[model samples]
Target: MKGPLFYAKILLFGEYGIIKDSKGLAIPYNSYQGALKMSENPSDVAKKSNQNLLKYYKYLSDLKTDLVHFRLDELKRDIDGGMYFDSSIPQGYGVGSSGALVASIYDKYADDKITVLENLTRDKLLNLKHIFSLMESFFHGKSSGLDPLNSYLSLPILINSKDHVEPTGIPSQKQGKGAVFLLDSEITGETEPMVNIFMNKMKNEGFRRMLNEDFAKYTDACIDDFLHGNVKSLFGNVKNLSKVVLSNFKPMIPMAFHQIWQQGIETNAYYLKLCGSGGGGYILGFTEDYEKAKDLLKNYKLELVYRF
Candidate 1:
């Protein structure tokens, strides 16, 4: 059986800041997507996937009483028929693999949940975020729910405040030399431990100061410049953002890229930051000259995301 499709997401700005109510922007990335389907194949991976879905289903079912409710019968029917996610999105790469699955489940199973076709108002969007947060917490231990929310809606969401968010527009791509890219870590990353490190770091007064001043400053600017299509300013802010991430979020950086991350700051060839929680996964990169950046990072796999 075919189910609703969920897209991958990118948190173009506000990785950690959004937790503190800093300005944030997330866009649906269609390059990777997932959907639920019934499979007759009984491969080990398929069996594991099915088992994972059963766990998530149980989690959702248990939380349905006070949170968003789903049509359990329909979900069970599909599950019994070997329903599993057929997706290209890589797991543990910070690209929303699990988030897409969570979104698809909610879209297909949730009764009276917000529909994508409905005119999404502030209240509905907030409710959706809340429900998706509870639903996704089963995976992440704790969740902001923005990833799954973005996956489900397939729209650009701008976080104005903790309680305020709405659909936003980003500048269309152009054939400029500057670009954003993803660097593969060749290993999977987990989200919870990385998040724990960030939380612990927040306990430091100095970290908090830098977060409020330097980190927030650049994060806010990046969001503004990106939304306004101010490419030049976006690059400048992204540079600072990259620097801050490198210095402060060191543990998140893959050891192999540590030198490259510093080299970019020193030489201004490219800026690198975490794509997600960032123990392994993918590291996001920004560079004014894609060719030069590619050459400098030649040893690693790079995927072009956008051009300035």
Candidate 2:
């Protein structure tokens, strides 16, 4: 038996800035997805997944929140029956791989689970995020819950602050020359270490100033420009955001790509920023001319996301 699939998600204009209550936007990525399944004869991979699920089941059973509840007995039954999560989403790639798993499990096992079909009011959205935050923390050690919220609803989410979230609509993709793409760094990024670094950096008042004044400003502008279809303004803000990230978020970026990241802004071929926690995985790129960016950055693998 298999359950409904949950797609991966991309945070288009939010990363470190969101932690400070900056406006953030996230969209579902249908290219990768996952679901819960049970097999009569489980493979080694499935057996491993089954074991992980049992541990996750125990974690859920210990959750103390009154916001949500799980059908723990049924979940335990399935875990005993070799139920496992089979997924195509790449882990540690910043594309919500674990988030999809969390969402799918919540979909099937949560008692009085929030249904996507219902009229999703603002309060309902925030409640869902709160629940997901608690549930997904088992994986990340700390979670904002935005990732699972986006995957569970399979809709674009706008994060106004830590406590305020809402469903949002982005401008339709256009058949034009500009595009957003993903550049594979080919190295896995650990969320905990990266977050730890950010926390340490937060101790510096100068870093805090840069984050609040420069990073947040540019990120907010980028989100507004993208949602409003202000192509020219979006690229402008993206360039600024890229520069800020390159200078301030150096540790999170893989060392090999530093020159390339600089070259993008210098030549206007593209603007690159962190897709998730940075350090490695996929780096998000925005280009006013996709063909030109492709030619200039021919040494790396690029996956097209959206076209302008």
Candidate 3:
């Protein structure tokens, strides 16, 4: 038995800022995806996945929540019958790997799950986020739930604040020189530890002030500028955001890419921001000229996302 596919997601803006009720924007990234499938003869990878699913089933069964209930019996039956998630989404890459898994499980087993076709009011979106948060806590120590929410809906989501979130439309991609891209850090990141560092940093009064004033302000502006298709303004805000991240969020960034992150800001070739929690994963990049940015960073691997 095979279930439907679930895609990965990119949190373009507001990574850590969102934890503090700052606005965030997340979009579906179809390049990497996963789906639930079953096989009579499972491969080694499938066996591992199935084993993981068994643990996840137990976790779900033990969860106490009114937000959503899983059909644990059927889920276990499927796992017992050699069902596993067949996926291309890389774990620990800042892309929504576990989010896709949570989304797939909910898609197949949740009772009275909110269908994507239904009217997704603010309350409904919040409820889904809440439900996903509970389910995904099995992976991340704590979660905002935006990753699974984006994967489940397969649409752009805008978080106005902690309590307000809704489906959003982004400016259509254009074949132009300006672009949004990902730079492979070539190092895997663990979300839990990175998040722990941020949590610890929050105890510093200076860090908290910077987060509330500069980080949130720039993140909110970048979201607005990108959505409005204000390319010039977007770059300006992205530069500031990148600078702030480099200065304050140093621990989250991998040591190898520190110089490049600064080079982009100085040269105006591109602006780099944390793709996810960012101990190492993919670093999000914004450039006015893709070709030139590509030329400037020729040694590093780059993947184009959206074109301006």
Instruction: Decide which is better by lDDT, 1 or 2.
Output: 2
Model 2: per-residue Cα lDDT at residue 139: 88
Estimate the lDDT of model 1: 0.87
lDDT digits (tens) for residues 1-308 of candidate 2 = 89999998899988988877889999999999999999999999899989999999989989999999889999999999889999998889999988999999999988898898999888898899999999999988999999999999999999999988889898899999999999999998888889889999999999999999999999999999999999999999999999999999999999999999999999988999999988788999999999999999899999998999
RMSD of 2: 0.8
Per-residue lDDT tens digits of candidate 3, residues 47-109?
Answer: 999999999999999999888878889998899889999999988999999999999999999
Worst 10 residues of 1 by lDDT: 60-69
Q: Give the clash count for model 1.
A: 0
Best by lDDT, which number?
Answer: 3
Worst 10 residues of 3 by lDDT: 64-73
Residues 1-308 of candidate 1 have per-residue lDDT tens digits of 78878899988788888888888888888889999888787677778888888887788767844657788888877888898888889999988988899899888888788888999999999888888888889988988889998999898999988799898888899998989898998989999999999999999999999999999999899888888888788888888899899889999887888898899999989988778789998888888899999999899899988888
- Per-model lDDT: 0.87, 0.93, 0.94
TM-score of each: 0.97, 0.98, 0.99
List residue ranges in candidate 1 displaced over 4 A: none
lDDT of 3 at 230: 97
